[model samples]
Target: MDRSPFPHHGPLRPEQVTGRESLAVDLAQRIADRRLTALVGPRRFGKTSLLKRVAADLAAVGPQPVWIDLYQLTSMADFAAAVDRGLASVVGPVRRALDSIAATVALRIGVLGVELTRSPKYRPDPVLSLRNLLGVLTSAAQRHDLFVVFDEFSGVANIQGGAGVLRTELQHHFQSLGIVFAGSEPSTMRALFSEQTQPFFAQADLVEIGPLSDAAVGHIVEDGFETTQRHTGGITSRIVAFAAGHPQRAMQLADALWRRVEPGETADMPAWEAALAEVRTNVNAASERIFSLLPTGQQKTLRAIAAGGSIYGAAASALELPPGSAQDAAEKLIGNGIVRRAQERLEVIDPLLADWLCRRFPI
Candidate 1:
């Protein structure tokens, strides 16, 4: 309806964002206050998009925000290098911004981190290297206040005692930089900050990034349809409701429905239903492909969660499962973005997938 078919192929840019205005303002405030905030939610819930938008806003206000995508980095060694690269554009242009000699911190970060990448002969102090890197960033922060955001950082940021060390050190030494740890995996994020033994324990405020409401998404759909002079006729409301407010899927299903409509035409109930079936069929098939790949008890757990039942063991039930097994399955489910913890209970994060699971495997 928007002529571009909702653009769900990737995350939207800052100007392209619709709704979630209050969340944006809150994040901006936390960043400016130099408070560490964990942005946690399910995948494709717009975490990266919000981070990018916040980064742009932080830069505008004079804190030189460094956005580092840690998705490609699986280890602390990789983090040091990627972080240096992320800051190179801003920190590289100057020779001696700080009082120290330019030669002191002028080394290309990749080269400094190269030893960690070597096969056999490499021996380097990871903690010292990380300290030096942070020190350099601290020096740069003097000129331009630093707002560092590690996007999708769970991969490397959960390095057991290693990340804990970094967090402790930063809290002690670097008070000038505002750091934001953001990821799409809700379970992992919760464990990172909520667990008493974890590195980031109780250090940051937890911001649960929930899905957009049905009515809000409806407004978005109507706006998109109006741009193309097409009438939505309540079809968008149905699609958004089916999508369960997950932003990406809602937009994607809306896009899928729009493809069935001719130019200058409004979608009626019948046309919308047909398109919904087509979209659901594709989603179900894709989900089934991975269904067998999950752990043995996981399918049962998925069906249980989909059907709005407890995944834990029950003395009164034959489908009862061990607590350890249930927790394992829950971890995988949350990691895959299929389920998330809503307060104390677990629920399917994707509504369409939940409906599909319920219909295909009623428990």
Candidate 2:
């Protein structure tokens, strides 16, 4: 059985990944210098894959990577558990250091073998367990570089004082550890790091990841088909044009097209159409949910942006929207990471969402 070359799910390794060479190099360099970095991007923008690439680069020389996903953590205990999961990868002196802390916190080695626990006495300390866990890692970092990456870090806001605890701990550990904080929600991440009143205000350097370049998108589509011994039949250009450099969309379309074409078969326009239909079907629910949750003005603005070309002018007029309303809504969407301005024209950042809007409502 010939498997699909495009992987749209989970993190891709450094060698298997494409379109982020410069970013990976720069990120690794910064982290190697013991800089605290904040990686900000929209959801499904391949931040994890890029992080993996950076980790791999740093690993070859030094720096052990500890990765934690904070996405559904609702409390400080949950945060402590997630930290433990990341620390499970640590070994040698660092592992011993964690073990020492584990004893003090009455950390139990459960049947599951997860060693992160908070003692009853310290449970009232809010995120003190987390602070202890990080303290161990940072102390270990004084000898060996520890690259700590917290993905979906905006969830820190969910815990009562998780952000405050993290900020205070990080201030003392800056010179000792290399840290990278990443989150999918641009609005929340901005508030966490950019707002002066927020605990993480001005704590780390900001790095923004956007859509892939056209050449990178082309490379993925073309290389996948060629490596599988399947001909692209000039459909690569069409896929590239539609994907507009969104990594997930490019891989999704490529995967769909690869499935449509048999071994030794060439991909054609019909294959492209079928693949697009499949993708649209899969994403319709999400697109609908996003659209339904938006305010009236923003919904109209999305439609206008999807229609393309002068969203505040002709598109707004065609959508029966006042220019001021459309402009204001567009600005709000941009701020929320839903839309972006490219070459003086506003565009829906998610290509599939824009495609859904175009198909469901012409204009």
Candidate 3:
């Protein structure tokens, strides 16, 4: 048993046992077929990590997979620049197509004046350029296929002022190419593609990335923590309970507990408590900041939701507020990744945040 610490951040590799094999396989198939796919989940649920794993697998099968993190891009120009950088890494016919467009557009590289040999300038209107670039890349790589994944796509929509228009435009331009759009907010993601009024309605298949099952979590605990302690099941169960099925939180809790327990020693109640405390503290601070930003009515509605054990009927009864107010506030919170409606109940996206809110406004 190797006593190595697990990575706290970044993409999870195939060697890692995160229990998302089904998702990876599904996404791989979609990419192989040159179909569009969308992954929806709450933040810290491993959306990005799962996509990276699937993307790696897709690239292995021949089509080059390029990943772009839309969170880093604030403006259209920034988004274009990031795409250019990502596309530059791709080779073969895709590279030729991009280069051809670069030559035709006379696209200049930034102040570096490096020219459009590999990277093109970040244009304010990157959609047109990206469309042209994708046209060439797709046409050139038609034989092999090219997969492009946009992570944090909801953030990109916010940057473009709602996902409606941008999703339509991107769907029109790149839906033909193998592409996957993933985001932590399911409501926003659904609105983009599932809603008929939206641009991408029914354009791509909707794939929900759910939590790792108990059995899978046990495997991850045993393998990733490198312990043959035989109590992997119990440890994994406790970790899942603490994280409430959020992948990132589960991993973080496991990592914390693993670090606290000494080699050859089994994880104990004390260590678990300590780890839980740390997670709660971090989540509380974040929830507090977000709660502070809400209007008085919204804050009251949230408290009522928490008191009622969910947001189902809290506004109508506990808060005595208009139904639309609650709905609107909930939508806003969902878009911001602060809250989500699941299992017919509205709750904080993060379990830790729920705990934090509970403590602050006790019923």
Candidate 4:
């Protein structure tokens, strides 16, 4: 393909996706066993790309798989329409039933969109429509071993009573179909399935997507540069380190660097600095906004973590945070998706972000 191996513009194409062999095997196993699985992580960490890749893999084999992006849904009608569209390819009674429901549901759109009209004998309320939709979807999958993937599932939680409604709908007969839910928001995704009083508590297996290895990302960047005949001594690894193992950031920084150098030329400090500056320009505003919203304690904790200090025990003293507040701050940061538990200590999720914070509020 005539594209950067390290993608920056958008989600990676199937051919460009790399370094996910182990994750793919685990996902395939879960699908084969028909277990409800969730892929959870911070935003921009390639969760959607991975979900697409896995869904595409299964669809290529046999049983048809349907992918619904919940981010685009607004009302219950949108939800019902999504499920109906997904099962349109099924044959016989289930397909007919889904068609009937679609025909009955009152939905309309016009230019800026073409007009769509449907008429049927009976129409159900939004709540019952959702319940019935799941019922028919399960029926459709039973006749054909189906895989249904809900991407950006975290968006559903934003709708009023959405979690409860979904839990009720799928409680009875979802086991027949292989389902995977993918979301970028870690805290909300965890709460949906982990809270004891919640409807889906302990229902799906949680797959936490951690940061990529510096080595893997570094290799990808180095290879991309070399493919373009642009050489780099250690600028590539530095980019990986600055991105803090986040795949998208690493790829993005690498892609930006590639553009600054010409073919058959070496990428020196000037090219590296220019690339880094571009990343800073693009990411600084958002990083600053996120940092500004934190309270004094969290801001202190963030600075400590961003500065790469041992933020667990005695290191709290370095942050000038009172004893035990560091832990609380760490928890808050984790909940906010600003940082996560690494091998032993907590680390900021985005290295470039850490640099931004460090430069903003020097500790």
Candidate with maximal lDDT: 2
Instruction: Tell me the TM-score of each prediction against the true structure.
Output: 0.83, 0.90, 0.81, 0.85
Model 4 C-alpha lDDT per residue in residues 1-363, reported as the tens digit of each score: 245556766577765666787887798779878888999888878777877777678767765566667775666655655554555544554456455544454422111011111332334355565665666666556566677888888777766676677777666656777888888777888888899977778999999777777777877787888877778767876887677778888888888888877777788898888888988999999898888889989988888888878766677886788768878888888987889888887788888788898888775
TM-score of 1: 0.83
Where model 2 places Cα greater than 4 Å from the true spot, the runs are: 91-93, 104-126, 309-325
Clashing pairs in 2: none
Tell me which residue pairs clash in candidate 1.
none
Clashes of each: 0, 0, 0, 1
Lowest summed lDDT across 10 adjacent residues in model 1 is found at 93-102
TM-score of 3: 0.81
The better candidate by TM-score, 2 or 3, is: 2
Candidate that scores best on TM-score: 2
The candidates, ranked best first by TM-score, are 2, 4, 1, 3
Model 3 lDDT tens row, 169-279? 455446456788888766777777877776677987888877667677666667665643423425667876656666676777787778776666777788888978887
Using TM-score as the measure, name the better of candidate 1 and candidate 2: 2
By lDDT rank, best first, the candidates go 2, 4, 1, 3
Candidate 3 C-alpha error for residue 177, in Å: 2.5
